[model samples]
Target: MPYTPRKAYVVGVGMTKFDKPRGERDYPELGLEASVKALIDAGLTYDQVETAAVGYCYGDSTCGQRALYQLGMTGIPIVNVNNNCSTGSSAFAFAANAIQSGQAECALALGFEKMAAGSLGSAWDDRAQPMEGTMTQLFEIEGDKEYEVDDFGPFAARIFGAAGQEYCEKYGATWDHIAAISAKNHKHSVKNPYAQFRISPSSADVAKARKITREVTLPMCSPTSDGGAAAIVCSEEFVKAHKLEDRAIELAGLGIATDSVKLYEDKSRIELAGADMSRRAAQKAYQQAGITAKDVQVIELHDCFAPNELVTYPALGLCAEGEAHKIVENGDNTYGGKWVVNPSGGLESKGHPLGATGIGMIAYMALQLRNEAGDLQVKDVKHALTHNIGLGGSCVVTVLKKAPFYKEGSHCKDRFGYDFAREERRMTQEELDKVRSKHFSDYLPPSVPESKL
Candidate 1:
């Protein structure tokens, strides 16, 4: 929360097609595709960026340097961030804060991931697990309850599934309600060209999908994905200087919160899974934006699992406490409903690459505000909210709206020389060259070549 007289705006955004991991591409190619496209979307080159924040969950130190050097060797600050699932938005927050603090008039926030196939696992094994405390808390809560642990699914399933079970217990929500959410997201992804899983399923099919746990099913989770997404954040001065008024989406409010006593003292599985963290962060963002959750028309939350999305509804103040089921049953979370949640299919259908996921949320919302989301666009969306969280844990809540000077579809034709928002097209070498730094290097080749993935 760096204070500044300047307001931050998202002037550019880009995302690669999310795919199931095939190991065909490395992080550099994925990272470069997103970075280059974002630069092109801004109608700017790499040299103009004063600083950069790059995020990824699994990579060596200096990966950001490796990723950015492909654009140029200007030697501006490049920070590498790893905040688990929320890493992408954390990088974005850092970039926005720099603009707000006047440390830089413009900054680049980039997130990329080249994840492996299957469930998320620990990269380090010899040390104490960061999630060990959560496991201890979970066991304490399940004392004498004789539930069998499924050996097949990732630990995250158990964590969120237990919390979802507790939520149902407190509020009398049937598991069908949770399965409906999965079905909705799966159906929504059908129109998203970049989604990894676009096949639609019925609520009954999702509920009957192979059980990950007694309380969790296969379609109820986000699959591991490989992709990259990025945003260009700049100060109001920069936007005016560049005549980007029409394209800029205001970074109206942002709040990041970590674990509190609620995690240890509440004894509520809902709170244990970072719902309290989500609430605190959402409240701060809402207060800053001068908008309530009731005013939100669109939302892109961290639906790493359907249960996560379910618990997050109340946590984000979208509904009253213990009443998330009403929103699901009333059809308020989909198109023609009160709010469109995850029109981009959510993590459940869209795929989740930890670092890129958060920035992807911003990319989607920014498109909505600019009226460029095409068939998936919500009607008349002026204000949007996003909630990204990680367990062990941190949460970043953001409220974004159309900038005062925003004009629908302005600069769309000039941006990337086509309607990129409506279509997910791979960038050409010509397009990449248009945004490369004037001070480009030839001594060493970029980490990734100017080619397709």
Candidate 2:
């Protein structure tokens, strides 16, 4: 008999607002805030979590333990993950697997990043770089392009910029189409309170933004950000024990893929951009879910660069090869079209805090599936897909759907006292004080005016 994985569901999800680097909060604070919100959303205490996987890229070893310690040191097994940009989703995959394998009934998947200002670069200078192979592949593909590797804004820009140039040459895509993608995502961000860039820009504005490369513009790339996100994953049995049916969003399918032979073997810049890896992972996820791209109503894909978004359209089967630009030109990639791609503003506008991005995507999808996305909600959403990738590189694609027993408006109204269709407000100081007094007496009281107290 074939092995059947146990079912897992995301009972709760939460995230900090993505912010520019060197923000007020550090990694520990960011992680704890997101974790606490997730726990509250699930109506559970941290003690219920049997295991945890924390993702980060710019931290010391065991950063997971340091961040999670804020939740109380319950001696649960904690796994630290760093798979570049895909770290968060990779951690989530591990957490879900723990439930599916019966190793844990409830698990926490959390990710946070505290990055420095400016474009991303290597942390260690005196070591064999992990991206050595990828760099070699890129140079081979761009042998005489007159592009200086170091002069490019970031290595990522050159990689995706080359891919975009390749795509246009092969598929007749124009630079305008790429700018349109950036513009669309920025427009979507205007409605997302949690996004980093809430101000929408016109396609012309995006196209005219400072160029990162010959083909990539400043607005077309994701900013380096600092933030955190978290999810509560539980087995079906755990969900039932907690009566979480109404709130649970089933993790219908998950697939993770790494660099394939094509990354090094193929001369195609599109392949070098990890499109093949994304394609394979998405195919596996669709297969596992017993669904296809046509079944998906909404998506939150990695738009670290606008060009990658276009390349990924075909990779995820959202469109045919060389036709991704048509989807953008026809307004088929946004609301009132075939699919609402990156309705959360995506990394392009939502911000990519590396570790936080994958789980952030999950949080956004959970909100959409639960009809709690407020102004960013997609209509009649049945199934949602998430694609998160990190160059070096790894990709994770996941499918989510409403739990079979889920009832519309049952969870949010009864538990959270909020209308799912409207914007969720931050908890007032009184509410926070109440929670702190009741469950966290050791915590220092909020510094407030004596009169207010």
Candidate 3:
């Protein structure tokens, strides 16, 4: 018999301020604090959590053991998940499944990282072998930035550079666009209390800052940071039975997909893969919750880089292919747009702490749904979505709605006033090709023959 999916509700969410990464804070300590706060917010006790899912990347096997030890949370199954940047949502999805399957009434999801004191390069190259030149020279080729370098380090830097150029060329967007994203996030962080960089930057100040390199800039990127975030998930019945305050968000849907690890090796465009994964996830989630993309009033996206958001808009069905840049250029993404994206200030402003990023997205969106977002709140938020991407490019999309769909007489509807849960809008190969072209560009080495995948 097919098992019925459980109706999961977000009962609590919490995170520490995302600031410069500090070694002094241990993983277990940060996780404990976040978990305790989430528990308090959910109106539940630690004893009520029958299971817990912890997400962390770069942390060794014992990291989960160390963190869970802080809360003396033992005996129950505590699964540790590490999916690069999407680790937190991966764990949250697992916990949601557990609650929906009637396995546990209440479960916890915690994400933590101290990457500044820790090593990010370790994730790519454990050896940390320095190139035969200075870090500066190593990043440049004949005084120009190099894009052909494929190993993770230089490759990431070059990708950001290319994206910066692409946005400027295609959309007439400037560094100010990226800065606007960071500035908004910082302002949102101010009220978050748990955000690391709560200091807002003026439009003029952000636009005038010097670039870190040709591609990367101070405001366009997140500083290495240390932080932890946690959440409590439970069944909708569990909340109603307890008569908990109606301050909960329902997990309408969850979806995940993996793209080719060798982006250069794959024939499919990276952007298409991401967008398809998100669309599939949204389809499933919407079908389960009975909502549609038009119904999502708020979004918290993975803005690890500004281009990520620019490209994501079209990929996520927000706009047509090759039109995301144009839409962004017209200020369609600011405070009063058709929909608001990344009100949490994104990774650029909120600071990306690897394991904690996905949870941080959820933490911010939950507040938005509960009308606790303060100045960043959407006027009348009914549905919201959170999207996250991981290493080499894995993607996850989770959707949330204001009310529990299964509640008696609580009709869930999308913008069309039909059920939100439904199949996705299918596309022909031509359409897919167009979207792919927008995401993956042909690499032209001025002097060398282009390497075709």
TM-score top scorer: 1
Return model 3's CA RMSD, one decimal. 15.5
lDDT of 3 by residue, 127-215 (tens): 65332222333234223435443333333444554555555666666766666665666665565554557678875666666555455
Give model 3's TM-score versus the native structure.
0.77
Per-residue lDDT for 1-453 in model 1, tens only?
Answer: 954457899999989989999998788888888998888878899988999999999899988888788788887999999998999999999999999888999999999888888888998889999899888888788775676543345788888998899989888998999999999999999999889998999999999889986689999999999999999999888988998887899998999999999898988788889998999999999998998998999999899889988999989998989889999999999999989999999999999988899999999999898888877889989899988999989899999998898755555556766777556787777876777778756554545554463
In candidate 2, what are the lDDT values of residues 260-349, reduced to their tens digit? 889877788999889998999999999989999999999999989999999999999988999999999899899999999999898989
Clashing residue pair totals per candidate (backbone < 3 A):
0, 0, 15
Error of 3 at 139 (Å): 13
The residue ranges of model 1 lying beyond 4 angstroms of the native Cα positions read 1-5, 149-152, 408-413, 442-444, 450-453
Residue pairs clashing in model 1 are none
| Model 2 spans > 4 angstroms off | 146-151, 409-453
Deviating ranges (above 4 Å) for candidate 3? 117-119, 123-154, 167-176, 202-208, 260-276, 405-453
lDDT over C-alpha atoms for residue 408 of model 1? 50
Give TM-scores for every candidate, taking all chains together and pairing residue i with residue i: 0.97, 0.93, 0.77
lDDT of 2 at 87: 96
TM-score of 1: 0.97
